[model samples]
Every structure is written in structure tokens, then in C-alpha cells.
Target: MNANVENQSPLLRNALEFAKANWWMFLLGGILYILFGILALARPASALLALAVVFACFLLVDGIFSAVRALGAKGAEGRWWVFFAGLVSILIGLYALFGPVNTVLLFVYVVAFQAILFGVSIFMFGVSIRKAVSGEWMLYLTGVLSVLFGLLLLWAPGIGGLSVSLMVGAWALVIGILRVVFAFRVRSLVRNT
Candidate 1:
């Protein structure tokens, strides 16, 4: 094991150690996202208000996890970006939870902006960690998908509740799967190390 550790690059070793400590955050977040996605998809017609609430809860928990992960990963590349993203998520989550978002259009705009910001941050983080992580492309893909989804929503804010629900559901499902896979990959790095 010492020999194996010695053979790995320092950055990779640090990343793996970080993953060992923080992988559960990813797993938990992914599971919640999956559940939310399933719920949204299962009843699109009745998912509008529920989606807002679920989105708020998801962002809050995910933000907390991301913030914790960033804090724990000292010296890791793009930790600050993760932290910033986490902060943004928290703020948005709080607003959505407490603010009076009475209209579907408002909700759509809020989700759209949040998704775009998150996607950009995740993409930058992936780029920063590419040298240390083997499957960084998953992050890139997730980020791209998020940005595209956000753009789609922004372009069609009047697409009605049903369409929004389906799109949000599909996006959440894909992102959840990606996060779950990435979490497992990070866990594998710990074993390899």
C-alpha cells in the first residue's frame, strides 16, 4: 500500500484522500436528487408547487454538503469555486423557501439562473481537477447539461407547468445519476490508493 501510494502523483493522492472523507456527501445528495426527480416525473401535472419546494430543499442540502466538502478539501484545486457555488445555492434555496414566489414564471427564472451558475461553477471545478481525477468528463457533461437546461427554461418560460415539470424531472434524473456514478468513482480511488 505504501508502494502504491508512493507511485501516485501528489495531487491524485490528495484528491483521493479528500474523496475518502467526502464521498458520502455526494452519495447522499445524489440519492436525494434521484428521489426528487422520480417524484417530479411521477406526477408532472401536480408537480409545479412541489417542484419548487423540492428544489428548495435539494439546493439547501446540496449547498451544505458542497460547502462542507470544499472546507474539508484544503489545498484542493477549485475549492473556492465549490465554496462559492455552495454559497449561491444556499442563498437561492433560502429565498425560494421563504420568498413569495407565487408565479410559475418567477420560479422558472430562479431555477434557470441557479442552474446556469451551478453548471458554470461545476465545469470550472472539473477543469481544475482534471489532472487528479480520472473521470472528470462526467462533471463536464453534467455541467453542460445543466447550463443547457437552464437556457432552455429561460428561452421558454411560458412553456406551462407540465412541460417544465418534465424537463426539470429529466434534468434532475440525469444529474443525479451522474453524481452517483462520480461518487462511486471517487470511492474507488480510495480503494486504489
Candidate 2:
């Protein structure tokens, strides 16, 4: 058994080792989501629009890359999805870039929908983990909170641009902080192993 464990791929071993050694990263992610919620409450409109523009840019870039890859494909599977995605991305990007200022609500709706989905997923996870650690309650709380936040944004899709910007900024800041912390935890465990 010991030899068999030792023979496992380093990547798999590393992942397990990291998870065992650092659960704090997951905790930080929860905290980050909470912080984002707070920010979303403060300035939803601006935050959402900025987020949308950024997403649009990403989509454009991805589309260009996908189009190129698809064109160069020798026999790769799912080349059509990639090509289609690329086209969609470019079109979305162009709309975001040149669309009227009044179109900001479109992005807000997207963000809200995402938040609701995340919330539902988290809530489900919390319910599933109700019998696990005593602290699974936190997951449930975070999930509920995420859902509420998303719903609120959806409720008033016409929220001002500044508000949306602030919401997005807060979300980015919190998520970025959490990701950095999580990465550190993973790094530390891998180093120790």
C-alpha cells in the first residue's frame, strides 16, 4: 500500500497533500465572497458595467484565439464550438465596446444571474455538508447571502453606472485577495511535501 501510494503521480499527490494541509484557502474564498456582497450593496451599477466591459474584452481576445486555433486545427475535437465561441465573443465585445450607455443593464443582468447561480450552488453544498464539520453552516450562510445579493441586483437592473462599478470593484478586490491567499496555502503545502 505504501509503495502504491508513493507511485502515484506527483500532481495528484500534490493536490491531496495541499488540500489536507490547507483548508484555510477555502475559508478565505468564502470571506471574499462576503466582502464582494458588501461592495455590491454599496455601488452596483458602476461595478457591473465595468465588469461587463472587462468580460467583453476577455471574450474578444478568447474569440480571436479560438478562431485562430480552429483554423489551424489538424483534427482536434470540438473545433466547431471553439470557432463558434470565438465568433460570439467578438460580437459581444463589439457590442460592449460600441453599445449605447443605456445598455449597461445587460451586463448587470448577467452578473446577477451569475450570483444567483453561485448562491444556489453554495447553498446546495452547505445542505450536503450539513453533517460534515460543525462549521458547514458558514457555507450555507454564504450561499444564501450570494443568492440574495444576486436577486437584489436583478430586482433593479437599471442601477446607475457608478454603483455598478463600485460593486464590481469590490467583488474583484475581494476575489483577488482570496485567490492570492488560496494560492499561498497551496504553495506552502506543495513546498512542504
Candidate 3:
């Protein structure tokens, strides 16, 4: 159900326009995520340090993109959550890059925290935009998967690098593909409106 352009709240309207404008980038991000996931799963036996670097780079780029989305969005409910999530992501990424905790447990906690925080934020955002976006369920599903993945990690924190890679990689692949699908929906919504 497309809202009349005149009927849309400025915030929602602005957000939709932003999504339409950046749909390509959003899709690209999803593709990149899928590739990264494939890489992780293919080499789950990679060293802890290597895995750490992969995760760190992922967090950094993801954080930057989240921040961009948050900044670009205006007047939407729960909007600040994205911004706050972005800040947390950047902090976690930087910590992963710099702080040498030298323990897999520490990495597990950080990674779990990042995923859970981001999932919650995106879930809220998706709910908030339900009336505006046809594919909000995709966002909700992505969030649910992320939260589940994080909880699984929290439940079993002592897993090996291969296990962690498989779990995270699989989740990323699913979420990324969902986002790519959702991006097309958004583009269609933009066109219909």
C-alpha cells in the first residue's frame, strides 16, 4: 500500500526518498556482505587473528554505512536508534581493530553485542516503517536472524573459530540476500509512489 505523497509524514517521506535514492548502494552492500560471508565460510579454519581482522573490517564498514543511513534519514520514529547503533558499531569495530584482548572469548562478547544491538535497532526501525515500506518484513526477518545468531553465540561462547565463522557467515549471507531483495521492493515502492 503506497501512501499518497501528500499524506506521508515528512520524516517518512524523506526516508522513502532516501531509500529510493540509495537503493543501489543498499543492494551493493548486500552483495558485498554475501561475498564476505562466502569467504568466511570457505575458510572457517582461518587463524583467529585473521578472523579478527575480517570482523574488524566488516564492523568498520558496516558502521560507516549505518551512520550514513542514520544521518540521511530524517523525522522517522526510532531514527536515533540507528545513529546510536552506528556509534556503538564504530566503537566496537575500533576496539576490535586496536585492543588486543588476545582471547577468543572477548571477541565473542564484542561480536555478539554488536549483532544484538544492530538487530534490535533495525527491528525497531522496520516496525516503525511498516506502513511505508512493502518489504519491512525483510528487515524484521534479518533482525530476528541476527538476534538469534547473537544469542546462540552468547549461549556457547567457547566455540572454535571455524564454528564462529560458520554461524556468523551463514547469518550474514541470509541477511544480506534479504536486504538485496528488500532493496528492490523499496525501489518499486518509490516508483509506484
Among all candidates shown, the one with the greatest lDDT: 1
lDDT of 1 by residue, 1-193 (tens): 1214456666555655676678778788788878888998999998799889889988998888888888888877677888888998998999999999777898899889888987887797777667667788998999999999999999989999888888888888898999899888878766776
TM-score of each: 0.91, 0.46, 0.91
Q: What are the lDDT figures for the candidates, one per model?
A: 0.83, 0.53, 0.79
* Candidate 1 CA-lDDT value: 0.83
Tell me the number of clashing residue pairs for each predicted model: 0, 15, 0
Worst 10 residues of 1 by lDDT: 1-10
Error of 2 at 139 (Å): 1.1
Cα deviation at 95, candidate 1, in Å, is 0.6
lDDT of 3 by residue, 37-75 (tens): 887788887646577777787888888887888787776
Give the TM-score (vs. native) of candidate 1.
0.91
**Candidate 2 segments whose C-alpha is farther than 4 A from its true place:** 1-50, 53-102, 171-193
Give the candidate order by descending lDDT. Answer: 1, 3, 2
**Error of model 1, residue 68, in angstroms:** 0.9
lDDT of 2 at 100: 55
